[model samples]
Target: MSTSDAVTTQSPALSSEDRSARIAVTVFPLLILAAFAIAMITPDTFKPLAPGVNWALGVIMFGMGLTLTLPDFGLIVKRPLPVLVGVVAQYLIMPLVGWALCYVFGLPDAVAVGVILVGCAPGGTASNVISYLAKADVALSVTMTSISTLLAPLMTPLLTAWLVGNRMPVDGAAMDILLMVLAPVLGGFIVRFVAGKFVEKILPLLPWISVFGICYVLLVVVSGSVNKILTSGALIIAVVICHNLLGYLFG
Candidate 1:
């Protein structure tokens, strides 16, 4: 092909939605780090927000829902192999690696259980933004994230119980998971399905909303464990990094 023709056929500029996703992926982690630092320094300030952690999570999940369209889920049917592979790998690998790491480090009971919980949990909403930024299959990313999140109440509790029951009590509340994760997601989907074009107009804003919600969640989580974070923050951070890198590598 001629140079001019090749240039002309190059992909168009990123849509505003994709641009927003990239921006979110870049900014959200910085925001979380900031929140974590602030909470460690001023635990009391964020302790009051602890009660609302579930609420903040719900908001984030809802924003995730708002970005979804029925067609996104259709990717599951159209491209079943990749989708199933991603989903199964996500649910299985992360948790197993997390459980293994707990023993490797001989982690304290509380920290060990916490790591397992993190592993048992599904993919976060931010994965969609990261996938978009990485030029990965955004639709497959969303579907995997959504499916795994929907399965959390069942899978997380079961996995945690099996992996950590002897070390710590596992009282998984299905209701809490339903309220925090499922309800808002379903509500967002319903709104998008019902509002159609109107929801499209606000799609660019959803990432920011999710970012805010996640930062708030960090604040609450850190505030509740300020002393633990302050005393073992470095160790926790190391374990978390190892866990995350291993999950990605395995996945």
Candidate 2:
């Protein structure tokens, strides 16, 4: 192949959607850092927003749903291997790693329990958007997230009990998870079905909506824990970051 042809094929000019996703991905880390600072500095501000965080998450998931098409799900059947691998790895790796971290850090019982819970929990709602921004397989990400989440009610309780010696009341949170996460996503898909063209027109904007919503979630949740964060936040933050890096490396 010719050099220019090779270059053209290898690095084509980004489409408007690609550009937007790129920009959002670039800004995402800075936004989260800023949100963390704001949350820590004025924790009281986010206290009021706590009640509505689930709604905010639903809105974000709805946006994620809007960006999808029926064909996006074809991969689940056509290529199931990746989905299976992702789900299995997610369930197996993160929980054990969290337990190991808690032990290594000598974390308090409450903090250790929290980490274990997070480990056993399915991927966050923001994962789809993050996956999109990273140019990863969104369909695979969505499917894995859904599968892991559906499995959580059983897996979480068992894993938490084994690791932390305290069983999580998954029965209670199970309904909330469905209503808050899956329901909104389903609603979004329905809307997309009814108005495919309109949804396509607005697809480019979904990443920004997701980014803003997730950042707000971070601030609110972090703000609520400002006291604990301030008291021994450094250790927690360090361990969390280390845990994340390890997950990335292994997963």
Candidate 3:
């Protein structure tokens, strides 16, 4: 093969992995929707798993971390401007948009609080998986998530107080988040370093695992509030969907 052909062509195995990742992304939302249905239909079944949601999130983060290398961190340092912009958007843009949605939608006090809280929250761990599936910069996503999470303890309460007149709790959340988010990620990073080749072979499997893990997490989360979900009016749902979509579009 000529030099250009060598540069342009992909190995069959790599092509397969790309296909699998694409399929995972395509089906991810459907699986999550089904999880919601199951939760709504049989909320009690998933209730017992409620306590493990944080740990489940941790496992998903671990899978994401295994895909990383020391070079990923180096990339973050090398390109600090984009990382700062992403972090700023995660905190400033999303939260303000959420608060605006609440006011425009005329959400009830309790529901408005929920919306604002979610907005004020850190970058969700799931974004890293989605970014990987999209073949985007997972390292940047991880770095952004880590920074947002670290800022959340302070920013969440401050934003809530400014927007909702009530301070969200700031105590002990950092330690728990470190365990569920940062610690598992570091452990996976180290494990990948120790078993680099084996981990590379399994990288394609991670997306599939993430699909089911995310479904289970969604199911467990929705099950915990089935009654509330059922009672929530269409307006609340519309506001939430708007907030989510707008956050993505603007961010």
Candidate 4:
């Protein structure tokens, strides 16, 4: 094929993926709202799925791992400063902003703890997709996500204890991080490293798997708190909006 034909043939696939990523970002928030409504309307329907929540989360993390390659980490060495700054900002600014918002709004302890936990959490894999869609530096996004996730076991737990422990006990934060974040990711990375060619074959399906897993987990979580959500969902949504917006602004 000529050069133009080669470029033309490849462009459609690349553009398709970009388009899908953009659609996902736009659709995710609406999906969350829909999940919440479903939970509130029929709590018992989802409560039975609670036992599967951990497994769903694990699948999501494993999907993240499958998408990763060892070379992705080299971005850290290629541009250390930006990666370091992003990591530091991810860990520092968001937690402080979350803490400040909690106080300013006088959020209930349960809600305050949730906000703090989100702040303490590492950069999510979705950011990589969003970066790709926005034509940002996908490598940098991946590096920041990988580093902060590796650091979550140490940073998330300690930060949660320090910032949120006063309001409530943060027992087993380290354990939670280990089980929820580190183990599955490490397992996925190891599988990818060992079976990269096979992993690549299934890579296109991983994102959809992750989306389904997350949706299931959200359903279970929302079901568990259906009553609270029925009463205070609006306030909770507002707080989440504020937390996310302020976090972006602060970062």
What C-alpha lDDT does candidate 3 achieve relative to the native structure?
0.85
lDDT at position 14, candidate 1 = 88
Instruction: Tell me the lDDT of candidate 1.
Output: 0.78
Per-model CA lDDT versus the true structure: 0.78, 0.85, 0.85, 0.75
lDDT of 3 by residue, 83-129 (tens): 99998998888789989998898888988898998888888778887
lDDT by residue (31-72, candidate 1, tens digit) is: 988998898888899888777887777777777667667887
Better of 1 and 4 by TM-score: 1
- List RMSD in Å for every model shown: 3.2, 2.2, 2.9, 4.3
TM per prediction? 0.81, 0.92, 0.91, 0.76
Q: Using alpha carbons, what is the TM-score of model 1?
A: 0.81
Output the lDDT of residue 1, model 4.
92
Which candidate tops TM-score? 2
The true-versus-predicted C-alpha distance at residue 50 of model 2, in Å, is 1.7
Question: Model 3, stretches more than 4 Å misplaced?
Answer: 1-13
